[model samples]
Target: MAKPGVRPLTGWLFVAPCALVFAVFTLWPMLFNGWLAFQDYFIAERVAAWNDFANFVTLYKSATFRLSITNSLLMLLTVPIIQAGALGLALLVHRKLPGIAFFRATFYLPVVITVSIAAIVWRYVFHYDGMLNWLLTAIGVFEPGHGPQWLDQHVPALIAVMLFAFWKNVGYYMVLYLVGLAAIPRELTEAAVLDGAGPRARFIHITLPMLAPVIVLCTLLSTIAALKTFQEVLTLTGGSGETVTALYFVYNMAFSGFNFGAAGAAALLFTLVCLAVALVQVRVMGRHNPFRRPA
Candidate 1:
């Protein structure tokens, strides 16, 4: 016979399989990576030895790692501009105006395209004989044969990457803003209008405040995406340019150098920095989140 209080245990029986899979795949790998960070694993002959804090010391002292961190932080600065572009598009299409649906669909088309594919498409555009250079030359913005080399330098490559990132992600963020805008009760805007509020005033005092939670969420997501940039850099610059981001460093160490131990250490440290940023997002925005109950 089944025990009297067996129902709770039965539910656990159903959950047990998923829990086991998670432990095996997620938890085990994390623990293993943590251990690897402390080991002195050499690619030569696949030798391994115990070494505590050696990776950390080398990583912290390396100038390349420092430069990578700087580049990552610099890239992160573009998130707000991306949000602004997204917000503008969302506002334009959130209403039931004529052709609004078409505009919304057009803006969102880029989001559905794969990043690698889009980057490849853009790579041609950024080429020396690309359309951008040709257009600039025609417009007298540059000499016919001496246009700027976008992928040849650090600043230009990072700028190209930022522009691509903004173009790629803005539409996705716009859809999120549209959802938040839809959830906003119409009555609030109507009341503000009846009270003689101007368009700018209503937006400043009402719409912006109402979109706070969504904006914060987008900021967090975009910040994470920006800081962990890799594939875009790989496809856009062929990983040969002067731009080497933190994730690119981790990738290079693991694959090119075959220093998995140092890579794991760098990955762990990068995760903690990202964790701190996420914690700040929650701490600062959790109370203002519309989903939260009033205290």
Candidate 2:
């Protein structure tokens, strides 16, 4: 056996490796990036000069940056769409039915696929003469060879990105809801049924209340993912001004434009926006938290 003090030390020893990696890879880089936001970083000469907030000023005045922000905000509309669709899917799959496991696996397949690969496949679907238009024509929604340019126009391109986001992420949220539904005590639902509560009544009263935490969690996650959307836009439009997002703007600034300082500022601003949204969500959703202790 070990001494009482030795056990605590050993626990810390086990945690030290992971803690060190987080400090080196995550903490240090974030700190450095924050520092870079305030300085004009010269890549070749390894020099950095204080820029006196010029980068942020420039970003504020930039039409492209403003458009990117608008597109990112527009992506927020998909959060509800994804969440509702996922909940519907989870409810559909939660029943005892033949071949339910296969259906669950099939729905979740998209979550495991590489995002870049999936976006590339979607690029083809959004192409002017792609399957989407072909189907639309077949359905008589569009005349032959007269479909709107999906990837060229701003509104359509943004809509395409939103569609891709929904298809790629709904299954993941569905799994989350499945787990939440599983954890709900069947006793409550069964008792409600015995009390003459119909399916809709039980779901509205018991099920929704119990699943509040999970709803909050999925909503928060979906919101963050929508705000940080980058890969879909990158692959679909290649940072075309129409579908460029804030994160993609940061990428273009750092890698393509070689303006690390501006990129750093944009990144910091975006991070603060994400943090603000998360805080607001927690505050608003925490009110519905069934497990919270009374004040």
Candidate 3:
């Protein structure tokens, strides 16, 4: 008989197919990207003799690459804004207010909407002569005939895309916070209250500590998502802004310019940067995880 807590040969056999698929699809591509970083591999020409990091050198020398890095870094700053807003929404909805379920559903509704649809809807809302400018005009902020170029300009386009992304994703994060809040032990809060602790004190000391795991998970996930921001930027700005991100640059390099090797190198570098950020986050916050004892 198989030893308890150990997998049998049959179980290993069962997992072999999944392991093979993962290795082929995910592992091989990653390895290939690393290889491509060293040489020039064109679409029609295919892979060439290794150039010893020439592609990487070229990537670093490009002005577009620098702009892409700055754009990605700036976009990442929105994560905390989103997480804090979501947490506030969670705290509000987690209360025993009337129609709480309805409110919770309303909060999550945006996440269910397709990104394409959201982008299109936002397109109209932020149009040069659209409802936003109309409201601004009505309030005398601007003349009826005047409106900001929401998508035509670089900065405004970036801001508009970020705003839409935040609105669409905040609900999903709010739901995650709600789940975390619900799982927190009610007795702990009651005990704090009994000890003459008010809401603010209890939240600061007890609630946040208990919710540390959830916060870490959300932070890491949001960081990755922000790093990989492509669809919204593509749909909203079409990679035309001065704020084109790293992924968009990769997309353009590979598809538009047909420079497969350089794109692959850029992608590999982006992956390394993302991994570094994730490691830094873990180093900073990993000790606070509830599942691990604090040193």
Candidate 4:
């Protein structure tokens, strides 16, 4: 009964359920959120009404919103450093050293742990007068009470949050790099070696060139993660939110301040900013992405 050189409509039927679910959960929320972004929300009115661009104008005047944007951008700056570190770790572990699998597993195990659980563990480690400061004191870096304030002070607070983000995600990115490194043909590296290319030259020309896609993927992932930071800020900074991120700002605007209209606009702006960054990343990396063949 099926047409020649064509399958039945069974393929569409098979995927219908997943498509419906995606529509209900993902598509609906996004459409509704986009609609709400232009509206004023009021408990008195018990509904939303379009207020045009008033919310956006008010948001631009908010100092806290400005600060949050600065903080988010600061976290975004860490993506390159973390990605480089992950690449180095992956390259080191990609070797056929004895028990390398064990080492890989150990490094990746932390990434599987729940974020809340990891945050709790880091809380104690980063607490004032905690284990880290104790070690610092013992090493004669500072007196017992003079260690860096990982949570309290403004500058160090941002640094502490960035450090936690790096620690949690570096292993995840490293695993991706490991896969890329493994896929590289041994012949290429060997050929470079025979051409009198030293270790640095070989990596610069052969290994790194091939891993461009992985690097771009990890950088974009980390940048988005940094932009949307929330749990780490809450747990590490005790929700005082000294280094408030854009997501946290939206949350506080909606829940704490009860400024639903401004919050919606902030959320929309944040999304647009993230989208712009992602587009920029794609454009920059698309030039040399090895996954694409010349047309």
Candidate 5:
């Protein structure tokens, strides 16, 4: 007899193809990136040689690397903003209100749009003479000929990137929250209502505690996405603003600067940071999960 928890041969067969692809593509690339981190590879030279801590030294000393890391961390500050927007929107639509489906689809428009294409559209809108400036001017928020340079400057550029990130991901997380809200037994809320618990009180005491796992998952996804932001910065600011994120640093080093070894090193560090965040999330949320064992 087979073990109680083990799946039969059919299940293993179903998973084999995807496992093969993962081994070939994802695992191979990750292993290569790890190997490359410890080697010196110049574009002119076809052969890579063993490098001893040189890549790490270069990565640590590079001011651009520091700035990119800072920008990526700064972008992480928007996770709360995204949570607030997505959660509120999810709560609004989780119930079957009039035209709820339309509102959900409209909110999800940004996620469906291609990143490159959306970046271009946003770049046009955020330009000095774009729709945003026009609206502000019309509303008398800006003096004539005093439109803010949303992309040309450092602070405004970062702000624009954060806003775009929030907009693009809000609906995605909202859907996740909606799923969580659905899984919560309706009777619990009904009982609370019958017991004279107000809507706000019910939400504060019952809804939130039940959705803990989903909130953790959303936070982990948003934080990692913010850390790996690249395409938005590329098209939005021509990849030349204070908004250069960590992933862009890797791209610039490998392709533009022809320093694949150093890029690999930085990539490894970024991977470590991502892994740490995920592990912490799992540890924290596992406590609330029914499947988790008592501590």
Candidate 6:
């Protein structure tokens, strides 16, 4: 039998390493990045001079930054599409049927593939003479070799990016919904059935309410992921065709252009936007959170 305080101290000792690592790697970098946002950082001299908020002012006046922000916001359109598709897929595969596991694995295969590889594959699919154009031509949507340049135009490129996002992420969300569905007590649905509720009514009244917390969680995750869209744009369009996202812009500013100060400012602004969106989502979705105590 140890002393009363000994166990608590031992627990804290176990936690100390993780805490130190987080402080060093996460907290320190965030603080340094915030500080760097207000300075003119010279890479060659390894010196930083105070810039009097010029970085922020320049980013605000940049048309490319504005367009990047707009494109990032536009990516939010994929959230609802992905969520709805995931839920539908979850419902379809949540049964005791033969070959169900194969279908589930097939859907989720995309989620495990490397993003660069997946994006490269999709780049081919969207190429002018790609399979998609071939299929569309076969269906009379376009003439052979006259297909739209999917990665060269603005709207088409954005749509292609959204499609890629949906394809890559929907399966992951489907797994989440499947777990949520499995956790739901079958008695509730049975009771609703006994009360003469039909399939649509049962889903509306029982399934939706029971899955509220999962729905909220998935929605928040999807929204944040959409707003942080980067790899798809980078690999697919290479920041061309007006498909540059906020994160991609920051990457270019920092790594490609060597404008670290402006990049830091853009990163901080993007962080704030994500934080605001998350807060708003929590406020709106808090009621559905199962962990919330009733007032």
Q: Pick the candidate with the highest TM-score.
A: 6
Which window of 10 residues has the lowest lDDT sum in candidate 5?
A: 283-292
Clashing pairs in 4: none
What would the TM-score be for candidate 2 when compared with the true structure? 0.92
Q: Give the alpha-carbon lDDT of every model.
A: 0.87, 0.91, 0.86, 0.84, 0.87, 0.93
Predicted candidate 5 versus true structure: per-residue lDDT over 42-73, tens digit per residue: 66768899988899999889888888888988
lDDT of 2 by residue, 1-295 (tens): 7786687679789999999999999999899999999999999999999998999998999888889888888999999999999999999999999999999999999999998899888888988999899999999999999997888899888999899999999999999999999999989988998999998998899888988889988998899899999988887788763899999999999999999999999989888888887777767776764446779
Q: Which ten residues in a row have the lowest lDDT in candidate 2?
A: 283-292
Give the winner by lDDT: 6
Considering summed lDDT, which 10 consecutive residues are worst modelled in model 1? Answer: 283-292
Off by over 4 Å in 1: 1-18, 42-47, 137-143, 289-295
lDDT of 1 at 89: 92
- Candidate with better lDDT, 2 vs 4: 2
Displacement of residue 246 (Cα, Å) in model 3 is 0.4
Pairing residues by index, what is the TM-score of model 6? 0.93
Who is ahead in TM-score, 3 or 6? 6
Estimated TM-score per prediction?
A: 0.88, 0.92, 0.90, 0.88, 0.88, 0.93
Shift in Å, residue 98, candidate 5 = 2.6
Show model 4 residue runs off by greater than 4 Å: 1-19, 43-45, 289-294
For candidate 4, the C-alpha RMSD (Å) to the true structure equals: 2.8
Off by over 4 Å in 2: 1-15, 288-294
**Candidate 2 lDDT:** 0.91
Clash pairs, model 6 backbone: none
Off by over 4 Å in 5: 1-15, 43-45, 136-142, 283-286, 289-295
Expressed as tens digits, the lDDT of each residue in 1-295 for candidate 3 is 7888776887889999999999999999999888877767755655467788777888989999888877887788879989998999999999997899999998889999988878888889889988888998999988878778888887888888788879988998998899999999999999999999999999999988888888988887788888888888888778765768999999999898877778888999898888888777867885764356656
Clashes of each: 0, 0, 0, 0, 0, 0
Error of 1 at 276 (Å): 3.1
Give lDDT tens digits, candidate 6, residues 9-92. 787899999999999999998999999999999999999999989999999899999999999989999999999999999999
Cα-based RMSD of candidate 2: 2.6
